[model samples]
Target chain A: MRWIWFDRFVEFESGKRAVAVKNVTLAEDHLHDHFPGYPIMPHSLMIEGMAQTAGILVGEARGFSEKVILAKVKRAEFFTLVRPGDTIRYQATVDGEVTASGASTTGRIFVGEEPVGEVDLVFSHIDKNMSGLEFPEENFVFTGEFQALLKTYRQQGGAKVAL
Target chain B: MPMSKDEIFDKVRATLVDALSVDDDDVRADATVMGDLGAESIDFLDIVFRLEKTFGIKIPQEELMPRDILQNPDYVVDKKLNAAGLAALKKAMPHADLTNFEKSPEIDRLAEVFTVGAIVKFIEAKLASK
Candidate 1:
């Protein structure tokens, strides 16, 4: 739900280096009561941010198929704290290819460079209906204007991003 | 997509013994993954990862946690569905309106397929367009 558009995307990328930013605003409901006068991003939310960042990587590695689910968190270390108004950077690498099931994919994640937190995740591309299976969709809500924003940003040469 | 119960169980057993180091005996139908075996949240998650890799499937957030197949004996659990699987769910189900299943009797009887591998094939078959 915290995932933003335009700004939280490939603001800059070149196969290896990519920079995505999430502007922490007081408008966030969590910031309202996190500490009255002080608003610090929760550690877990930081990981979610990392997950979103990593999610984009997976989307790029493969096509942006809705099937890919961030499956596992191999490792994550939090060394600092993320507060409102700060933009966290999620950097990753294509360590190698993973051949599981009957498909081959590149596994990757964000290693927190500045030190707040980093996540080692594995994403799997899957089918929506396997059996009588239904998953919780409450946590994930796509911002309605995401695609439009992406298109608009493309027009602006990826320079202006409103917080 | 409809794999037999024996085949599903065999795959589940392999994931347990091979990936998680759990004994084959511990992976039975009524095995009680988190309830009886003391498998922590992380352990269950790791098992889910093993399932995905082993079966080429993904478990979405909504269905992954509740389907307690290792504990429940009645339901034959399958892999966690992805977008395609979800589409298949919406397509194949004549009563596609799932607005009521949340409160139906199947809620309790529903056996969660904890591992991604165990449920994918089963789900594919189950959700295939009939």
Candidate 2:
């Protein structure tokens, strides 16, 4: 199973905000073993979904030049449990200027039109923040798989989606 | 109207509480950000972001923590800051009180300089300059 969380970007505004959706289904092996009889979408994965949604937004804001890594989960609070057949909508907005060192993002998670949770995250441009550390030359964070998702979004009429 | 030191301290305390998930009482002025409040390396970034938002200020990476000095061969010698390094650090962070740090300039103890009070002073200076 691939590590990609959300299905696709539904709405994207460069340097500002992006929205993505994910459909929960029992076909996912983790849901089956999570409770056996009572299957609810794991909160941890939901946070991951939010991270992917916000993380991509942050990475794209900088033209994917920096290896944007999720540095911290500032806040994650869920109001309700998500179940199979529910479509999770992740709306992420950049909280402030995307500095060379790092950026902070505020996110809202919704199942259909009703709000289910919120996940606020912080991402570091590792090259700028990790002063003494060294990472690979290539952009490992935004691999082909992640970029393909953005390409798919652009092909699906997200004309404003920048490369 | 300019905010008083108490007001700035209150706001900084709140920011530290949110960023570090520590109790309100734990955010005393003398508390070291990493040692007493338990802030990891990444948490410093988070705190900087929060401080920027809370105070409506732009905090450059070097201004808050001059990691470059630690890595500079001329500034650091045998894991300790030389006289030149101490002067450079002082120039970099006028907001921080380096009296105690000056006595023994070990690189390891650099984190001790960033106490909650130091942050309040930093913000006070930034706001005053504006």
**Candidate 2 residue lDDT tens string, B1-130:** 9999999999999999999989999999899999999999999889989989988999998888888899999999998999999999999999888999899999999899999999999999999987
Candidate 1 docking category?
incorrect
**Candidate 2 lDDT score relative to the true structure:** 0.90
Q: Residue A153 in candidate 2 has what lDDT?
A: 62
TM accuracy, model 2: 0.95
Measured with C-alpha atoms, the lDDT of residue A163 in candidate 2 is 34
For model 1, how does the per-residue alpha-carbon lDDT over A21-128 read when each residue is reduced to its tens digit? 666678888877887888877766665665655555555443343444556565667776667677666555433332221122222223244555655665554343
* Cand. 1 Cα-lDDT: 0.48
lDDT of 1 at B78: 49
Q: In candidate 2 chain A, what residue range of length 10 has the lowest lDDT sum?
A: A154-163
Model 2 segments more than 4 A misplaced: A156-163
- Top of the candidates by TM-score: 2
- DockQ scores for all predicted structures: 0.07, 0.86
lDDT of 2 by residue, A4-121 (tens): 7888777878888999889999999989988899899999999999998888888888888889999999999999999999999999999887888879999999987898999999
- CA lDDT, every model vs. true structure: 0.48, 0.90
Fnat of each candidate: 0.07, 0.80
Chain B TM, per prediction: 0.48, 0.96
